[model samples]
Target: MLPRIFVVVLDGLTAMHPSPRIDRLYLAGTLVATSLLTACAVGPDFTRPTPPTATRYSPESRPDHAAPTMAGDAPSQTLRIGDRISAQWWEQFRSPDLDRLVRRSFQANPTIDAAVASLRQARYNTTAQEGFFFPTIQASYAPSRTKLSGNTGGNSPGIQGNGSVISTVSNTPASQGGTAPFNEAVIYNWHSATLTVGYVPDVFGANRRLVESLQAQSEFQGYQLEAAYLTLASNVVAAAIQEASTRDQIRTVQALIDSSERALKVLREQFRLGYAMRIDVAAQELALAQAQQSLPPLEKQLEQTRDLIRVLAGTTPDQDLNEHFTMASLTLPAELPLSLPSELVSQRPDILSAEAQLHAASAQVGVAIAARIPQFSINSTLGGNASEFSQMFWPSGKLFSLTGNVAQTLFDGGTLKARQRAAEEGLNQAQAMYRSTVLTAFQNVADTLHAIHADAHTHAAAERAVTAARVSFELTEQQYRLGYVSYLTLLTAEQNYQQARLSLIQAQASRLGDSVALFQALGGGWWNRGREQRAEAAPK
Candidate 1:
């Protein structure tokens, strides 16, 4: 958007008119820029890569087809190709607690604040560098009382006829430079006022390259900020799912303990009749203890998960959060948007960040090469100096000067060439890093797609296990009550049912967790965000 480096150079040429020396500088730049847009930049110019030729993410196009799942549990998720990813991807889960958690995290999170600050800093630096395109103009006033004597120079001011002789004598050296000399040290006021201007035009585009580099860095931080947001939102969703799974585990274990206790009572009644062995009662009691033993850790995990959510949303563990999540509270989206491989490079924050760094490195090579060439500058000072304050601006006592400067490195044991080579190496490194980041991004999306498909199948299996265990437990309960099954057999069925139920809860959570991961992997749809989602801004 700010490709005005050459435009600013033209601005210096047009406004306020250039001197003969300045005209040459402008003419040189205009001639070079007119030949080619990249004439000013010495080293290799940066070109954004074209999208990959492949139309699909996978060879078999894994996500182009719908995933398979069991009928009763989670349904198959169909990839909705060419569907625009929603900026509010998390809201697809339809959990208000999650929505609130993500909202609060964007506002109150310290990580977000730091990223914003970095973005702002980069913005200011870019702005400051842009200003270098214009001349630096300044004004100054200096008043002094100085002693004029035969030692330093000539006569003191106002020493002759009514300021007339003093003015004439000051402008002319006293006849042969020896006629008049100060007999004694006398103080006189010397007033001077200056209006000056200076400009260092971007003739070779070194400064402009610097500005380009800074703009890329600013964009880099913007992507980084987006990455922070994506990460925080994903973490909150994952933590919420974990909490729900932990709660289900605790609930299931409690139910299991209750079942074991009831079975133990029935066995005790049988023991009095000598129909049940003491070992049978002991087995039931041990089952009860084992189920109870599972409770504390699951409870601990639930509490810890809640605490994690609180911290993610920028609240202390002690702070009360009224919202609680359950498997029922969240809804899995039936359709997921899959970004094509060609578009993924632009959409992914990490990929874009790496690309921005690469752009900056490309600019750096220009800057280093320009440093080896001759640099030009123009300076002018228009001012006046007089013994009287009122006369400082008058034409009779005015002073003015103008100068053009050129600097070129003669030799530094090849230091400038070495730096240019080093910059080229750095560009190479950034290119490699950018390629790595893109590969990683593709892997992330592919892995998430596979996980979603696998999770649905896993949940399906778990659902079947849960159903079978539940039916077996019911049959065993009836048989034990009728003295058809031993207490130990009933306890075994009960434990199996409990484990199955726990697995089902975890599998259900996995489906939800996988959905969050998919949304993150698809770049969190940050491109649609038109403004900051919260009231936070970078500190000035």
Candidate 2:
């Protein structure tokens, strides 16, 4: 019987043990493999949202297909400044001042700094999430001395007399493996040291999914930073253009003032010669005063625009931008590039960010669903122990153990199911938001295009009106001097002429501003220098 028992024990040492926990892990792994490779994901996977049905603005019309062309003749579709706008669109204005200011803004703007910080934060987060893929190992040591009760056999051995021993009690002594009676206390001393290693692999790929989700988030932020950069570029360019427009208007008004003063002098001479009424001179004087009043406001506006650019460029507003950079004249591009709405989606960083967010939401659904599956952890502890401190490393004193645990939330009262549903809802919401953003972007581009075109026409008509008014004013002054017109009539013509000139100046500025708005709406000119910087700084 003893030989058979020994043989059985030896056989057990060579045989494998069946573990239900390991079987479950294998089964879950199989499920994950099949799902990732073959099964369609349950939640929405991101697809780029479509833009508008019409590529161009509804009210805006292209030039006639058969318009005559010449080598030096400009295209009607093109802006006056150039044929195609570069990624650094502001440079097309050919202003060194603008280039320098934009560069300074890119470097010093607080918003840009914040965006860079956020990008760094996302990189750190990615690194932290990656650590989950690796295992953890640790070491520990413990030493202890234990004192047994005095009734045990450590101090004094039990004594028995041949006749005094109870008959019921066995006379034989207890062996090492058997229960025994002893008279003295027993004591024990031991030391333990261990190195433990453990890991819970991504058996269901839940951890991998989580990392994917984080990567998507990181990408989303990257796109957001791009969007911010684009916005900042647009702001600086627009501000510079605005400042130029205001200064030009101030100059135009001053010219108007000079013309009005000349007319006023003629009116005063006529009044002194009894050919014009005192009221005529007084009215002309008032017109001149009003024109003079206009200059201060335009000058104020110009200064304000300069200050805005300075702030955006991360410089003191008191700094002289004009001294460092000349305002580039507002020159229209010769031909505006019309991008198909479908392609426009790729151009806007905000839209790309939205798409990335949708992807993250999709991955989150997988993460939530994975929680319902079993988790497997492999654990081991190798240790040394000894009865005496000095002999702690002896073979007989060494001890070790290996352990494994598989945990699954068998029942969670529908909590996991709800989480998955929430993730699905989130994905749907993101998709909806992405679609909405695209539609809105299309609307902006279209509206801005129409406005720019319409303003151009308006400004042209205003120019003609101002010219006609000036001619009428000159003729009326002659008539008044020759006593062919009344003072009141001259006053009426003078007022009309001044108002028309003022209107022309305002219309010019408005048209220039519309050009800026159109470029902003198109999200143009943000890629070149910004892309260069990105390339230079990108991680190796």
Candidate 3:
């Protein structure tokens, strides 16, 4: 059993011996018994707030409320309107480097690690709050040697009675230049040890209210972790896709430059043979220079994008990841995940985290309101003291005391009220922020959807342009061979065809990038059971 001590000190108050009031407080009939009885807590409970009714910016013209179903074995053979994105969505691209980079980011990203640490800290705080519900114990010990002068104040019974007086000094001697009395000296030694235990019982549940706030904060931290995970994955995927697009553009431009240089070479030979005018040769040379100029900028962009992918994949600044990262091998997805407006509320981690913040603010408001109530505390002590250490446990020397204190703030200049008002305003601010986040998420999804649709048409048009330019160039070549048209005419057709090809590649890349953006807007396929299981199996 734990030891307890309760010492109540009332300043400048004297006690009369064996009084009825003292007897009622110490040896009381029922007050002492009731004080030791168990107690329960009382406070407001927690309930989740209701979310907004409509999940979309606008209403759907037609409704299909049934859950999505799968039919065919292969995804491409049966593309449905509501098929969820695969957990390993990037795997569909068939890029091994992308797969490895995403997994490394999940394990080694500093931002994700910071979020995880914050969650663990919140969990520890919750554990600490839980410890308050149990009892507490403490032990103390003090030993000292003392000397007393027999003829000093110790000799006066009225001022030095055993139960009536408490003194800080051990004794005073009357021997040195004594005014009225003889002197004598005595010495004594004493030792003592004590143990104490106490608990607040959470009788009014103020402690529980504080703990509830902490738990809500912990849940908020969990939402932070989820949001961080999504952000890291999205960044890595976007960078990789952008790099792939850059690589494609670089190849397209290089081909155009080669064709332009060949035309310029042929035109120079014609000028030397006196068959082509100087003006025509000059035009070919200018075209070649323009095409050559475009290559360096595109190559630089491709290099920068590749380096960005390397950084997102958790590589050092000086590390060369270009050898391990190649864009030519990636396969672009033909389609993206279909998302319903209603699912956005739960699917987007950042929005969910904002909602959690709102909930925490609401709880803090309750805590602020609870602060206006009265406070109560109980303390106690049980021990014995005697002149002889061996007799300290005797019935006559046994001692115990119980104390209860209650306080209420009568006047604080309305500080508490101002704090309550501040908390209420904070809750309102959080609500507005949550609503804003929801709207932003909706807008993001709508924009991505529009781009993907538009880029598809653009890509098709560019493909047609390339085909027509190629046909035109082939016919012009035949004309040049038959001496019906000049070589300059043939070069013009070839140049148009080359430009068309580069434009087609750019359109293709844009379409693929917009597809990835759409999936990211809908919170598609970053974290799921498959990735979680894979991470668990990985070496720590």
The lDDT leader among the candidates is 1
lDDT of each: 0.79, 0.65, 0.65
Encode model 3's per-residue lDDT on 183-210: one tens digit a residue.
4455554445554455554545656666
| TM-score-based ranking | 1, 3, 2
Candidate 1 C-alpha RMSD relative to the actual structure:
6.6
Q: Give lDDT: candidate 2, residue 449.
A: 62
**What's model 1's lDDT at 101?**
82
Number of clashes recorded per candidate: 0, 13, 4
Better model by lDDT, 2 or 3? Answer: 2
Better model by lDDT: candidate 1 vs candidate 3: 1
Q: What is the C-alpha lDDT profile of model 2 across 1-540, one tens digit per residue?
A: 112322332233223233333343453454345334323333334445555575444543654211221212111234322223356666655667777877788899999988888888887897898887665668888877766564433242122221221112232346655465534344555567876666565666677778778888898888778777778888887787677667666766787687678778888888889988988789889988988988998888877877888899888877765533223355554445555567667767777788888888888887887777777665555556665565555554444444557788978899999999898899889889888888888888777666666666677778778778889988998999999987656766776776786676666666555655656665664555567668779998
Score residue 162 of candidate 2 by CA lDDT. 19
Error of 2 at 62 (Å): 6.9
Task: Compute the lDDT of residue 93 as modeled in candidate 2.
Answer: 54
Q: TM-scores across all candidates?
A: 0.84, 0.71, 0.77
| lDDT by residue (tens digit), candidate 1, 74-169 | 466777766787778988889888898889889988889999999999999999999997678788999998755544444445532224433222
Q: Which candidate is the best by TM-score?
A: 1
**Which prediction has more favorable TM-score, 2 or 3?**
3
